[model samples]
Target chain A: MISNPLFFVFIVVLIIWIGIALLLFRIDRKISLVEKEVSEALDEK
Target chain B: MFLYRLVYVLMPIGIFLSLLWVPPANILGDASRILYFHVPVAWVSFLAFLVAGLHSIALLIKKSEILYREAMAYNSAAIGMVFTVLTVITGSIWAKVSWGHFWNWDPRETSIVILMLIYIAYFSLFSALKSNPNRWGISSVYLIISMIIAPFLIFIVPRVYPSLHPDTIINQDKKIHLEASMRITLFFLVVTFTLLYGYIYKITNKLSLIIIKLRSSHDI
Candidate 1:
């Protein structure tokens, strides 16, 4: 096994990757909702 | 289908984690371990552009609004940029260890720089179209031109020039010797990154569709 310090760096990179993935997911979801609202408003007009 | 795809992504992550304990010497070296990440990034980047190119061809043929040509163009360009960066980082590190320098003007390195520039221009063209809907057609045409150029840069350029980079599998003269364990680890890495690419592409394309809808509605 690698040293604890190297292992910690690996864990940190993994966590950061997961965090970025989650952020992108949230942004996509929010964008989708905004688009739906805009489309509905346009239809009303 | 979504759950299955999610499982596909997780499985590679699991495999990669398991392989980390297997010792660096079992592969090329402590440095060879980078291939587990580097080669896959290159492979997935090429695959992304191939997907984008196919979509471009489809758009040129069908001309359908819902065909997702623009989404493919944008998303592939994004992922390609990511992988290109990964390639540079890993390649530089490997070169430092293997060749005594970080940034050799090797044929492969130069080709990658050109490849990155082409895609950067592709993305810039998309940004330029933001102010003019009438330019999408022109932008799409430019993307098609990029697709035509990609194959030559990827396949032809490196072959035509003498390269200092070692080819593990491709070339006959300078093949790096890899143990069986290393080969298996590399295979898993490629699978993992390809799955990552597919997952991101799905998410981004969905997001792009929403943005397109939003823009169209705003214009009305």
Candidate 2:
């Protein structure tokens, strides 16, 4: 097992960064869907 | 779009360089790694606020696409709030490691807290005026006034009072304190985080625009 505490800190930071990235990606995807719907609605008018 | 993909890749590399590649500071040691995250987020927070302020000014001057401009400014402020909170949390963590206490009330710390409060008040005022027709103008003026005060809080206040915060990147002599490798890592991370902020701001702005469109069209 890696014993250094700094390593663990790095791991924690890594996990947080990855989590933020995933959250942003999900939000972007949802926004894209909404954007498409709005564009279609505008087209209909 | 390619730039958005680049954030996913560059961010991990930035993290790696910050935590592993750069040599630990002679005094702060490994705890200094937090600098990579803290400073970048703080810079982003300021950038977001500036963008919001500029958009507010444009909204007032041009007086066109009120919803779009208001949405951009609001979204910027929202992103800025998140990053400002991150800066506080990360700074507190660093302080705990360096000072053996979390809440030191150092000048920079106090100033940042006050800055946060100012923005929080702006947000509260925004929500309270939700039903008012002059909401956009009033909030934009509030933002502009706050922007005027922001520099005093961020730069002047910190300097006017002695603090436990470390030496700034650019010291009195106008020399960078960081060594070359660390400087490079810091710059890389700052750029990557700014790009990440842009990606997020873009998405949120698009969503807000769509909402405005739907509302205007009564198509929701």
Candidate 3:
């Protein structure tokens, strides 16, 4: 079953999943930036 | 406790992967491999939504700070999205091999899409509340309404819709007949994903708490 052409499709989807995961990871990293900014603003007060 | 839970979840995944490398296959043959991923994602997504709905109920009952409720909503929404994406990927692969298409608009597939959209909307509502503290009530109301809609999306819609997904595994309409070994592997995978969901939830919840405190203090 893994030999079937559908397996190729799965491989493509797997790549896409990896890409999305990486993108989400980057977005989450930016969330930390936002948090830091919020902290700095609070400290100013 | 967290370390113990982590070990418990990982051991099964390790064993399952080892079994995959073995020559003689288990109960469901190659199809059983899908159990390692697909079932876990489906189970975890369901569990996340359940958590979200429960938290919504708690917020309504207790009327705690909007921050706590938002944390619950955000964590659930994030996990739900990840699991939903996983379900689509795994299910599509399974379908292509078994049903000869990437998609068939099957009842299960359609219902899952609908479920995914609902969560997407949930997340969007949360994002909208970020600029205005007063919007907390609106977000909470949305969460409550979404919770009310979840049961229908999860159960009723799938069953009622015409689907190519197998309705019966063997002689029974509900039970799938897999060898004991495959069943054990699948059980382990489900447990592993559930634990992973819990770990992620905790981390996200903490982040949300910190953000809330930061916001409140800054406003002062």
Give the winner by lDDT: 2
lDDT of 1 by residue, B1-220 (tens): 2642563456436444534553575434655566677788888878887777777767767778733676777787788789888888889998888888999998888888888898888788778777776555666677677778777887778888887765546666766576676666677677767777887787778777767766776787
Docking class of 2: medium
Q: Residues B49-130, candidate 3, lDDT per residue (tens digit)?
A: 8787778677767877767786777688688789889899989988887788999988778888988887888778777767
Q: Which candidate do you rate higher for TM-score, 1 or 2?
A: 2
Off by over 4 Å in 2: A1-4
Lowest-sum lDDT 10-residue window in model 2 chain B = B1-10
Interface RMSD of 2: 1.1
Specify the CAPRI tier of model 1.
acceptable
lDDT measured at residue A30 in model 3 versus the true structure, 0 to 100: 71
Worst 10 residues of 1 chain A by lDDT: A1-10
What is the two-chain DockQ of model 3? 0.12
Candidate 2 has an lDDT of 0.90
Error of 3 at B155 (Å): 2.4
Q: Which is better, 1 or 3, measured by lDDT? A: 1
lDDT of 2 by residue, B1-220 (tens): 6686589889988988988788999999888889998999999998899899999999999999998999899999999999999999999999999999988999889988998998999899999999999999999998998788888888888888888887898679798989999999999999999998899889888888888888988854
All candidates: TM-score of chain A = 0.76, 0.86, 0.71
